[model samples]
Target: MKRFLTLLIAVVIALSAMSTFAENAKTLKIGTDAEPIGFDPHTTPAHASIRIMHQMYETLVELDDDLNVIPELAVSWEQPDDLTYIFKLREGVKFHSGRELKAADVKYSFERILNPDLGALGSTPSYAGNIDKVEVIDDYTVKITLSKITAPFLASMSSIYCSIVDSEAVEANGDLLRADGGTGPYTLGEWVPDNRVTVNRFEDYWLDGYNFENIEFYVISDSSARMSALRTGEVDIIIGDSAMLSIAEAAPNVDVHKIRTRDYITICLNLNMPEFSDVRVRQAISLALDRQEIIDLACDGQAEVSGFAPASMGHWAVDVNEHPLYKQDIEKAKELMKEAGFENGFSVTCTVGLNDHIRNSGTVIQQQLAQIGIDVTVQNKENAQYVDDWKNHDFEMMICQNGAGSDPNRAVAFFFGTGANANIAEYSNARVDELCELGAGTTDVDKRREYYTEAINIILDECPNVTFASPYNYYYASSSLEGYSPTLNRPLDVRNVTKE
Candidate 1:
């Protein structure tokens, strides 16, 4: 009897310990569609990678819920002149590696990003492309000198790609993604390729209210798989489009949130390619596309047909109705094709990413163009390969998404400006380039609008790329998850999030 009692006591103690662990160690599991390429904020440009950077690193500034610029590592900033800006850093902030945050760290981080030998992939339109030099004013302040007056510099500082890293950590760990050490809310704990990433909450995080002990980012590329994970209680949150949101809403104890974004889908035409060299051919292709039909079929009416630029770009985007090319006129398309010496239309391959909406848009475009006697052969590839092919200019045409920028200058520069790495279409117009420079250099809203409008009009007239639609993003969270508000730009900020 004594032996049995002792054994029972041991079992009870173990059970109690397990319960305590369960209560103390809360984890929020999220089903992400794709895995990020790396954790390096300076180089990784893709959306998945940017989301990870937001958690693992801290930027000099951040955006509030309204997309307004707010303080993060830097308490405040002031423009000393058109070409120079100064930042006052926050003191007592601790990096994950235990080094105190200082102005020199900021200077080194910016310098590393701007280094040509470093070859940062995502810095062109924002950080390295705009800023010329960084000067440490003191232990608590830094001054940035720009080659020219960049109007979007403040907002760009809030971008995830501009997140600051510890110089000591980077030197010790080498320039590797997984070697992340920053003054952020979390640290990468585990990464299983094509499976999941686990992050542990930093005990010394500067920001408060990050109550969850762990966050698990599970890879579920398939839409159904992601929803299934959420339904089966394997994941507490999943981000999807409108169709997936409908299914998630029907599930028990799930809440759906809508995010407005400037992200747009475009059929990027290779202007240097044989069939697309003629401007009439490109215009015909745009007229042949029924943007509304594509949006309705592919996005289930969850998207709006945008003009050549995203409507979310506020004053910069020309109204869709103002552009005659946006209207699908099959007869006019045929006339233009005939004028361009291809009345019967020519077959072209359109490469697309593995995402459902992109592939579906390609299919819809294929069917719609067939009505105008154009044969569009759809070619689908994985996301990474597609991005590489795009950068290499290896396709006749391609369907892809363009990320939103802090200003019209960024959006215009990304797709149409010369020397922009994101200009996959190989499009360049001297006038458009001049306007982009003008827009970037000016702080006057009216003057900037004029420059952007002219550039947008020129691109639309030239038909370098067909901007079809902007799809609304949807995210589903378990009812117990709180403080998760969707935004136009930042999607993965879970700092203040708590799972009840």
Candidate 2:
């Protein structure tokens, strides 16, 4: 009896010690790609990097699990006119520096976003493009006046780029933002570029306390390196898709989480240019390769052949019947080429980033196009440089991927509208633009769907872009981890996450 009692006492002591240790733990080890260029929310625009910045800043509004806009910094908002929106800010919120968050700060935040000198306008054009001016009503109230009625205006603000920053912090930072100034759930604790970024939990965050004690982000771009880190217990989580599933499925101590993504890989053809102006040439380009095979080789059988934008995304994804671009017929492609007077295939340069997936897809696409008598010269460039070149219209053909949001209008307006940054294809269709406008303006969901469905049909018929496959996003976590909920539109919400 004494022996059993002693064993029970030992077990209790061990459990007590573990509970105490967990409460006092102050560091979490996370692995990611290279560190962001800067800590400034406006300057760090890369999707991976910006997600980290979002942890340092809070937005006025956020999307819930269902992608519905809910209160975050702003308690509520009202539209007084077609072009004016009034917002009632949350009271008593404080920045990390102990400054009160006010309406002036909100106004300054929008103004900073609109400032041409900030250089963020290019990446977050959607937010700035709609706003004509901002008016401060009081300490906790502000009104945003737009140049025109944009139906998706509030929805656009839910994006990461629209995160509100402390105006005072920006002025003090003067281009190089300090680590610990925002009012997010975590404050930047330490930063070692290309190595690691550490953030400590902010007890005074506007929201309830987050479950994490600390977050440590490590930069490891290689798939093998990340897998090794997870396996060896050097990191607690991996966010990217490369080699995530294989490692998680094989490892006893890791859990793999998958999110259905609207992200799709596209082959963008520059339609405005003379070389690609012919419809036959575009048809030939589409015919040259097997999209399913590319999905198999590039994504390791993890992706789905995208059929006219993802249906799960929202109303703007035109019904498959409305668009015929998803269908692959090599014979039809040949016939179109003949009709366009290109009896002999022409040579064109295909540009792609040197990232893992991009390179893999590019190589497969080159071979596929070659099979259809189209000579494709693949040019590899650094990811950042390639994005710049594509935006500047410097490439004949470019391979790119787009992470679509829950709202289909967000995707349609940014990629299909006139002067859209993603419209590198320079595709201009008056009828398509009209449909897009009608869809965006209507508040009725069914009516909006009808308009977008028509717009998608026009886009498919025009064939401005060729889609290969839609990739799924995968994350790997240590088995000891809990409360790790992954969202399709947002990055890992580390706020509620805990490590055992």
Candidate 3:
């Protein structure tokens, strides 16, 4: 009887200790501008969803904090020839769905993204569209062959677009947009649209150092409200702008961090629209708007007046502002408008995202373009509707940020490379396509620069889109949060982060 009583007491004490440990596990809450667009990395375009998906998915290769390619699922890879690469996976990596990750799953993921008829309409497909074949050599080995020799092939795999998923899970469910099939550190827990998204840590995650039990992204659209939440300790961090950086600087307990990014605030013109079809008409619109003034008024003077690529691209970046097309020329714009058969500028709607920067820029652009007799009506739709409209190419002109990277192909090719996956404008130019291909096929920096320069010059004259200001990815976090660092691409890496 005494032995039984002692055993019961011992079990009770162990249970109490376990309960306390579980309660002590960290839960990170972040205040974001918006909720995820969807959970699927291959089908996610906007920043809101990409950030969440990175936490929920794992690519074979991933970008480190320095934007360099580092092995994730793939321990190592070798290129036997210019066109073929063999990847070796680590042991015992498991997906959030069910079973362990295998080479077949990687093959399946590549095939799924490269499938033309799959009708997956996201921008991610382009990163893998060059893949000609994916063959599973064994349970832990896979070989991939590109259609052609490419300079950035290895770095391309580092993109979130190359995330690997469970083949069986995807086969059972057409897509994993709302399902869990990733082998990342975290898996989707619950999501309430336009409200909050919670992702719990994966117990079977192959890598170590993810100490947080779960991470929560609370959607707080209003910048001021997000600041308030940060102040009240409702959120550990917030995606903020230069304005919020000032606020964080003022508060003693808040920490301000900024990543010099290659992102650009641009106006996308749909070519299908008759008004924007004529190159002269597009050029006129581009010439009429003042990018510097827009940057000052809308971006709080926190952005750089740049070309298609941000200045951070260094030698590869184009300074379109140095050319006449980007200079504000009202008379030339009016003359071009008359030549395009619109003597009195036509009316068009400029769709803006649900952010103060975009809204202010759109409004300022509306006033700027009016100088050339163009009638601009600015419109702001709800989050879902706006993303839907942008995806469907339903807008005449949309004001948004163009996500660029350090790669030469990223700035000129991602959207403008003719038949590109993310070419929302449906624009095609044979010369530009040829130049982009030439740029990607070589490792010679000088040769690549010449090719990209020609392409950007043509794009500027053709005016498929107008680049205005280059903005930085600014973050505000509490002092208690440690090990959290943001990359230039704005993908969140919380695996090493801890909350005090």
Candidate 4:
């Protein structure tokens, strides 16, 4: 009888061990607002898809906690001159399909960006403005040569546009779709376009192992729906505006994270038009509104009043007071409008995206501008249509919001340069362009700052954009999750995240 009892105890212990192991092997379910239109790192660089792809693809460089570029695929790099950079790729890294990553692949990936047939797939001119050539030095080394001295070279590499790709996979797939061909910690398992995407951890990943076994992304675009999903445990996390913070704070088993982002929402004025060419008119529009009131009503006080773009994340933020563009004065605004012959007010169409936060803010601005005698007709369109219209410069004014590039130079260049993607304002000042060019070509920090400061003054004086507020990156995570680190400007990196 004693022998029989010992055998029974052993069986019980074995079952308990198996149960523990099963509990530990939990899969995390993450939901986001729509998979980006394309999965190609070059095509849909800024879309949510790249964030998901980052798990499946490794970049040559990755940003650290302080927002500085650090080596990821490239073990080390050196600048032979002001315009040339040589990177030594890390050896032994393999793609998800068991092929080795090579320097030739890096060259191919970059060259793909410059292809004219790819449309906007080309390198973001704002960030890659100075890059002239990419030369493969050897099997594991490549040299990046710029046309001019670029201070933000490392920071520019941190962009999704520069993320490394597997050449074999690109050749096979023809375009970046939902597939397993990257060198990241996760591998694409399934993707349902516009609805959901799923990634499973790559067992043969070259870097540290991912915490979660699988990540499932569900696109929940509606703010209310996203909040409901988070509260009901249908999803593990939801990223949205400050308006969702109240609901998030009250929800059980939910944690709300608010990080200051480099994103800013402003009014993009068409400077190419004669009416908006007057700087006083631009300044008047800026000063006429009560920005703080708008922040409270529209964003629930979850935004910071912006001046000349937001500061870089973490320790690199320049002193806010040192920048003059952030100053607010209503009387001065009215005076400038009168000086520009718009004291009697004029009818203008303000185009806005239907994104909840943007639409809500546009509504608030419509009321505020009305108080100043500006007859603003608000036009709300779907996000895609709004982007297309804005890109083509087809609107008189637009409710524009953009996340700044990793570097200040890149950020300023995109918005203020002569013909940049976000330069919807169409306002051109020779001085501003010169400053941007100078800043882009200078490697010295102080010299770059001088150029940036001069450019900021020009933008403020010109009033291309009626600067409003810089919103926080707000998201809710399940209480059971751990090790999720959020960056200010970039999308959430889920490879290191794990559930408790």
* Candidate 2 ranges with C-alpha deviation above 4 Å: 1-25, 33-40, 43-45, 116-128, 173-181, 189-191, 211-213, 319-323
Where does the lowest 10-residue lDDT sum fall in candidate 1?
A: 119-128
- Model 4 clash pairs? 34-219
**Best-to-worst ranking by TM-score:** 1, 3, 2, 4
Could you tell which candidate, 3 or 4, scores higher by TM-score?
A: 3
lDDT of 2 by residue, 360-417 (tens): 8988988877765778898988556675686577888888877666666656666777
lDDT of 3 by residue, 201-316 (tens): 89888778988898899999989899889887788888888777677888887888887777888899999988889988899988898888998888887888877677787787
Q: How does model 1 score by TM-score?
A: 0.92
Q: Over the stretch 322-416, how does candidate 4's per-residue lDDT look in tens digits?
A: 34444556667667778878787788888987355577788888887775567888998755567568757899878876766556666677777
lDDT of 2: 0.73
CA deviation > 4 Å runs, candidate 1: 1-25, 172-174
Q: What are the C-alpha RMSDs, in order, of all predicted structures?
A: 2.8, 4.5, 4.8, 4.5
- List ranges where model 3 is wrong by over 4 Å: 1-25, 121-126
RMSD from true fold, candidate 4: 4.5
Residue lDDT tens for model 1, 196-225: 888888898877888788888888998888
Per-model clash counts, in order, read: 0, 1, 0, 1
**Candidate 2 lDDT for residue 15:** 99
Q: What is the TM-score of each candidate against the true structure?
A: 0.92, 0.87, 0.92, 0.86
Local distance difference test, each candidate: 0.81, 0.73, 0.81, 0.73
